[model samples]
Target: MTRLVAANRVISTDGKEIKPGVVELDGERVVNVSALLGERPFTEWLGGTINLQYYADEQLCAYKDGKML
Candidate 1:
């Protein structure tokens, strides 16, 4: 099943806060990225626990650690 993860900030491999984006996943594969302008597979970043930050009303909301954020 495909799932959507809403996040305020995404930590890159270089440990940088990228942008507020949505990550779409089909199981372990990242099928889409909202910050990035195309639909592609991010295979390297797959199959691991993803740390995500959530925001509500322009404020920090929650932090999650999991495969689906």
Candidate 2:
């Protein structure tokens, strides 16, 4: 199924903080992503993160191993 994820913050692999963003997922794969209000580019900002954490509406979700956590 497809879902929309809203992230408040993300910690990159290089230990950088990524601003909030919205990610569109099909099951566990990222189909599209964009930064939230007052944030940077999602693709560029999430470049080094092992795990992507975001909010699916109100619930917190993690993306890893091609699946949602």
Candidate 3:
């Protein structure tokens, strides 16, 4: 199954803070990390995954089908 992790801020492996980034995952594997400049909303990066973890303001929140899990 595919999973997604979106955060208002992501601390990169290189020790950089990626503000408002999105990470894509496939099962237990990471597929992509997006922190580009765009006109996209958080909903746009959202995929059809029942398992999603979102972090905002240093708080971790999980969502299942758009509802808190």
Candidate 4:
């Protein structure tokens, strides 16, 4: 699986602008988006906490143990 991460702007709850500097992903699918919020180390590292993002799939791929659906 391959994924790409980039920066984008979004409107925050406080009506401020936020940036998702890095987006965590799994195999051409987005698993989480880390916004530029929270404390220094956290924000500086993974950028921010994980906020979920979704990708289009005809069927959800779920796995159990070490198998692929």
Residues 1-69 of candidate 1 have per-residue lDDT tens digits of: 776664556664446664655566665455555553334454233322245443344432223464233
Global CA lDDT computed for model 3: 0.51
Candidate 4, superposed: residue stretches over 4 Å from native: 1-4, 10-17, 37-69
Best by TM-score: 3
Candidate 4 local lDDT, residue 25: 43
Q: TM-score of each candidate?
A: 0.43, 0.43, 0.46, 0.32
Model 2, range 1-69, lDDT digits (tens) per residue? 666655555443345555675666676555555556754333233332334554556443446444563
> What TM-score would candidate 2 get against the native?
0.43
Q: List ranges where model 3 is wrong by over 4 Å.
A: 36-69
Candidate 3 residue-wise lDDT, 1-69, digit = tens: 555566565444445666676665554444566674555443345433333344455434444365653
Could you tell me how far off, in angstroms, the CA of residue 5 lies in candidate 3 after the best superposition?
Answer: 1.9
In model 2, the worst 10-residue window by lDDT is: 41-50
Give all candidates' CA lDDT scores: 0.47, 0.51, 0.51, 0.38
